[model samples]
Target: MKVLDLQCAHQHVFEGWFGSEDDFHQQLERGLVSCPLCGDLRVEKKLSAPRLNLRAAREESSATRPEGVTLSNHPAQAELVELQGRMLKAMREIMTSTEDVGERFAEQARAMHHGEIERRNIRGQTSAAVALELLEEGVEVMPLPMLPAVKDTLQ
Candidate 1:
């Protein structure tokens, strides 16, 4: 059975199961789809996951993962999950107390270094040139391995 994520004309989301893609198309074209929330017939596939063609010939060229084989999930996966949980918790605590100075990282750091501003925790973005300039001025700055892109959405 093939499972599909479907969205109605009214933006109501639902899932549909079918024997094949052709069966799904046939049912959809005949207005067989009914939105669970509003009971609307106008529905379309929202995000259909790529169907892996399981043709025997194609299988020869592709490296198939053994069904029983998995990662060292018994203990390592648990440890990794625990580590992630701890990191997230720590980050949440820090973000709540820490101040975000945005893009004026260099200027803010300079002010703090020169005692123009009170010394406190600050986070922001800066370019390589700005960072180098700060270093030349003997301003102590180290790059943090920030996970998320705080600047803006990628174009």
Candidate 2:
């Protein structure tokens, strides 16, 4: 397996695994590769050094470093990446657990809130005005940015 660093037009960095270089190219040509954050199709491979598991070297370096000090040169970038991963994980969980009510989001939410329909987890699109109206009516609702990549399984 080949792991390659990729960046989309939106500058969201991610990793793609492929059987070979040709396989990666083939997928890119077919528009299968996409940014997980924004679902942008314009992706490019980034220069990345090969990962080496040097446990002894890591141990020696850690011994010299103070406790609570991180090894990442770009700490902010590392934190951002970690945050993005967490957001993606939470999004995946929400997507899997909720029923997509589509444009009927407001109606369904209202119905469930008033006990007219069975309460259940749901997700969908609604205008800002409608969402506010729902909230005013005491119907709990939250907006979730739906990325195209989240709507479909990534290759």
Candidate 3:
């Protein structure tokens, strides 16, 4: 298996795995390679430093992290991890500050949209039907990943 660094026209960088170099070429020629973000097909390989299979060289750089955590002492990589943590922390703060109506998300959202309830930040569960309904009603809603909550209450 080979992991090749790739980039999209939007400057979003990502890595793709292939069985061989020819496999990557074949996939690209077939127009099957796509950017995971925005699903853009107009992706082109950027000129980058050549890859070395040595473990030390790979570990020397900080960009190999599939997740935010890393076991390397690379300062560049540490900065990336720190930035990721800050972003995640900011998102958690927002989620914790918002009201959680749970399954009543759609109901509460519509109520607020129609002036039946006070407008405020809220977070909760909603079905596809509810999401579509909210969109039809011009209610601004955004789907977010499940995030960790703030430990405001003592267990």
Candidate 4:
């Protein structure tokens, strides 16, 4: 397996695993590779160093390193990466748990609120005005910004 660092046009960095360099190229050419954050297909491979399993070196470094010290040179970047991962995981959970009502979100929500339909977990697109109206009418609704990648299954 080959692990490569990749970046999309939006500058979201992620990793891609492939059987070989040829396999990666083939997938890219076929438009199968996309940004997990925004689903952008304009991806490029970034320069990455090979992974080395230097257990003794790691143990020595950690022994002398200060407490609370992270491995990343940029702490903020590491935090951002962590946050992105969390957000992606949460989005995936939401997508899997909620029923998509599409543009009929408002209608369905209103029905459920009025006892015309059963209340259940749901998610969909609605205009800002409609969403506000729903809230005003005591229909509980929360806006979730749906990522394009979250709408499709990622390879």
* Cα RMSD (angstroms) for every candidate in the order listed: 13.9, 3.3, 10.7, 3.1
Q: 2 or 3: which has the higher lDDT?
A: 2
Per-residue lDDT tens digits for candidate 2, residues 1-155, read: 99888889987878899999999999999999988899899999987656657998778877998764445324555566778788887898899999999999999999999999999999999999999999999999998898766666655
**TM-score, each model?**
0.44, 0.76, 0.46, 0.76
What is candidate 1's CA lDDT for residue 7?
63
In terms of lDDT, the poorest run of 10 residues in model 2 is 68-77
Residue 117 in candidate 2, Cα distance off native in Å: 2.2
Task: Go through the candidates in order and give each one's C-alpha lDDT.
Answer: 0.67, 0.85, 0.70, 0.84
Best by lDDT: 2
For residues 56-145, write the lDDT of model 1, one tens digit per residue.
634653345444323222254345445654654555565667688989888899999999999988877899889988999999887764
- Of candidates 2 and 1, the better by TM-score: 2
- The whole-model C-alpha lDDT of candidate 4 against the native structure comes to 0.84
Tens-digit lDDT track of model 3 for 1-155:
96676666765455678889899899999987876543567777655455566888667654666554444323554564455456557676876699889999998999999999899999989887879879988999988766322322211
Off by over 4 Å in 2: 54-73, 151-155
Candidate 4 segments whose C-alpha is farther than 4 A from its true place: 60-74, 151-155
lDDT of 2 at 68: 46
